[model samples]
Target chain A: MKDRITGLFYILAVILLTTIHSIELYIGFFVLLSVLSGKDFIPVMKKTFVAVALFNGVITLAYILIKGFDYGYIALINLRVIDMTFMTFLFVRRVNLFRLFEFSSILTYLLVISYSQILLFKRYYTEFILALKSRSIKTPGLAERYGFLRSATGFFIEKSVKNSSEISLAMKSRGFFMD
Target chain B: MIELKDVSFSYQGRKAVENITFSVQKGEKVVILGINGSGKSTILKIINALLFPQEGTYRYRGEIITPKKMKDREFVRKFRKEVVLLFQNPDTMIFNPTVFDEIAFGLRQLGEKDIKEKVHYWADKLGIFHLLDRSPFELSGGEKQKVCLAALLSLEPEVLLLDEPTANLDPRSTGWLIDFLYQLDITVVTTTHNLGIALELGERGLVLSENHRLIYDGNLSEFLKDREKLLEANLIHIHRHRHDDMEHRHYHIHDDFS
Candidate 1:
């Protein structure tokens, strides 16, 4: 499917799944979508299941204590949430976000920038952690931990500001604001 | 044409560049050579109008480029369209999903017709045509640099400002870029800590001291031959070594220290 069409379909599916109260229908739809999505379905379903179980477990327990064991309502709510989450994962995996938002160039640009920045942040964080691990011969003490945290926070803040400014200039140099 | 007179800039009360004066005629190529943190990139930013000089004037053609002048949409549009800067980090410069889209970005922003053709042309020129459909984030540093170069070059800007273009590139890619840049007829100003690239990029060189002063501006060949000037700029260090067979004297760059 075209990315834009897939995005639109995903949105519609989310709305439909949320409104529908039938646990059987939601389960049927989830199974169908899972099968259609192929290889990524299992992992997506696993993640959605864990997330939904943890979140709804608390709420479902409280409800059961207050009222009674309502298997139908609890099952329906949990299934709906799982279906929505799975659909979102499927959409993300299927669609090329940059291409999906190409209709709005500015939006596409912003998405690309944000995505790159997120990757950069992740890389920086990982490097810091790795460096800390490599340098330490023993467990870090309280003072050492505090120092590392302070330094890491300062570095992250400075890097974020620097990256944003530099990226902004790069965009401007390319006539990104000309339109 | 571009000119800067008595230009100075500071970041958080710390000076980056000071009392800088230089000019480039139409179609002239100039290389700014300096050690790291010597404000070479800062000068490029000022030229691109990305940063306003805190003192003195920066002019393109004849008119002064002030913050007020840049506020004028028309002036900014014209300036941005005419002068383009390739940042030091290609990773920061690339923010598109695919190499093709990244190269086509500037053309699209400028409302250029036949963006595909321009993108393909530059991509082919840069030898990144095969990677066109691939994600820029997945590319190697050299490939990313080529993609960024293609993107900026596709716009056909009159003035090209490159900040440490060869910094992250491998030797082969660096050679390719040098060869490619040597053929361009545009007004080019590039910054580099590598004296070799500076020498290759242009005959004229501007050396910024560690303290952010313009210490040298003239023939690059002459400037490079002067060991004192090079040492003063912190570009190299003289090291003496003795082997079992013989003694040798050489100058080596302290890359990490710099």
Candidate 2:
């Protein structure tokens, strides 16, 4: 019951953040979140910044260039995104999404399988970079870099196709898609 | 030719390696033994200089190796050429368009001439001569592994660090690899969780316990003989079964029936 309530609460917060444009409320809420984050304040903030910095920077720059200088408008746009992101992060950290989504069995099943795949591929990608670093006798040239990128992309594409079919077969075998 | 003093490393807030200290003399074969996440691969990374030690010093050929030291172009060229690492996944090590180019990459990078001759030499030696023109991406797992090995061996590295080299190999490929590795004169450090093959990989073993600490570093045969050390490293397990309707329990080493 608590998980479902928390899930709805986050959804409501997102709706409010998007629909309402009160800058003062956004600022206050962000401050409250930072304080609530407490020991994780720095790490959480860092992740939020990394996730949004480039994106927000480009939007802010484009807006200023197109419409001239406007501090209030810029602040509103940036704060809205930052707040939304922070709330999402905090909610994920505190709430178990699987439990929250228990109302839908299929959704929960998809999450379980995809989450595991996400983790595995993330490590595989890291290993690719480390492998290149380990084997490069000197700085990689342009041709080498291009080769690495091509091969990495090809590998992922092949893996995705193979894994999807394999997963589909497993799901079918388990009567997941039975008519 | 390689030394690590009080080496320790961590990922995020969790410890991966804790106060690991060891040295490998020229031409020494050492096997790093640990279960998954027990810091076997992390130790290999430190030795290969892919990951630097957070709380200790790594010295190669009497020079303290640091990220700063790796910045020197001359040193990087020398160090990388001298020490090479084969990742657990062969796909990660290979990215070239063709097997020939892949094997020739390191030599070409170092401005070495006769790349074709060297590439062919190692390819023939590793039994991948037939796959020279074929794309490495399309090869079998064992073939890809051989291609990656040929690529590294073509560089003629003195120290070879293999991370779970046989984790993806079949029985025949694994057997062939063991035989192939036995003939190599270079210093080899292999990491594996399989206690059965540890003896075949090297005479010496460095075992890491679950807590990410080095529990034992000595003769592997001696290590195998000691059941206490095997249990401490989680390399052995207690199994219960019934023989003719009689229930009994006995400890068994992983992948080793005897």
Candidate 3:
């Protein structure tokens, strides 16, 4: 029941934050939620700032050039984006994604599998990069770097397919998907 | 009761194992021993019906098993529940958010009542009860293996198929697992390249040659003493060395390091 409520709240928050037009309200809610979440505020703000800047920086610049400086509207759009991002971060930190989707076993399974696969991919990619670094005495050239990336990508793709198939078989053997 | 008669499989035209014939009686523990790339794991996959045999038939409890037959809903459910395969990598087998859920997953799928009781029983049996709420991903390699074992064992499968169960485990955990498996009264088919561990796990051994053939299948103790057979299977290599001060040279069998 708690997980369901959390899921509903996440959906409702997304809808409200996306639909609401007032920038001040978004800023206030974002700040209040961030404070209540009790997470490291500066780091959360730093990540949110980077994401907002990268996502809206170009659009804001283009809008200013075309429509002149409507400071209030531009600020509202930027703040809304940042606020939405922060809210999502908070939601993810607060709720267990697997439990949140407990109503749908298939969805929960997919989320878990995808999460593990992503972790595996990251581990493999990091190992590949570390191996490259260990082997190279000096900085690699463009062609060498390209070659390394090509091989790593190939390995990653092959491993992903193999890992997914293995996981599927393992799950099946354990009575999953029997229904 | 599982039987494979003249079973053969290939991957994209590359033959894995061929002309394999074996039958494991109920409550019997059998070990498949082979070096890397010898198709030992492929044989286990075939037994679990994850891969179908291209040429022969597999029988479970006197009924011939085939891909088409497995399509039947009832048979698939029963077969999966009765025969569980614990993957070599615990990471691949573990998909639940916590250890408790991981063990409970199989029972829930089978629609088994008293899921919490069964999960707790097996977790306690495997000495992982304390880790019930912990994420499986956060566990050590041995702990992960135990959690996976608990998950599969909780289902109380009739036939347990393990593929290199100790590959990622430490010596202490491996010892514990061997002892635990010995106490379990269940039919087990395990694969391993380690000759000593295979002897410890089971009385009968099926040795796969480098070319993916069942070169030897008999008493593991006798098989280990047969130096020529071990050499042919590439499980050991004969080496000769002479000390500078010694008058004689001696030849010794060097077991495959891996």
Best by lDDT: 2
In terms of TM-score, how similar is model 1 to the real structure? 0.59
Superior candidate under TM-score, 2 versus 3: 2
Candidate 1 residue lDDT tens string, B80-138: 76888887666555545678877876676567899999998999999999999998877
The most accurate candidate by DockQ is 2
What are the fnat scores of the candidates, in the order listed?
0.00, 0.92, 0.00
Give the alpha carbon lDDT tens digit for every residue of A62-107 in model 2: 9999998899899999999999898888887888889987889999
lDDT of each: 0.81, 0.91, 0.80
lDDT of 3 by residue, A100-156 (tens): 888899898889999988887875665455434322323455755665676566556
**Residue B22 accuracy (lDDT) in model 2:** 89
The alpha-carbon interface RMSD of model 1 comes to: 17.5
Chain B alone vs. reference chain B, TM-score for every model? 0.94, 0.97, 0.94
In candidate 3, which residue pairs get closer than 3 Å at backbone N, Cα or C atoms, i.e. clash?
Answer: none
TM-score of 2: 0.84
Accuracy of chain B in candidate 1 (TM-score): 0.94
Clashes of each: 0, 0, 0
Going through the candidates in order, their DockQ values are 0.02, 0.75, 0.02
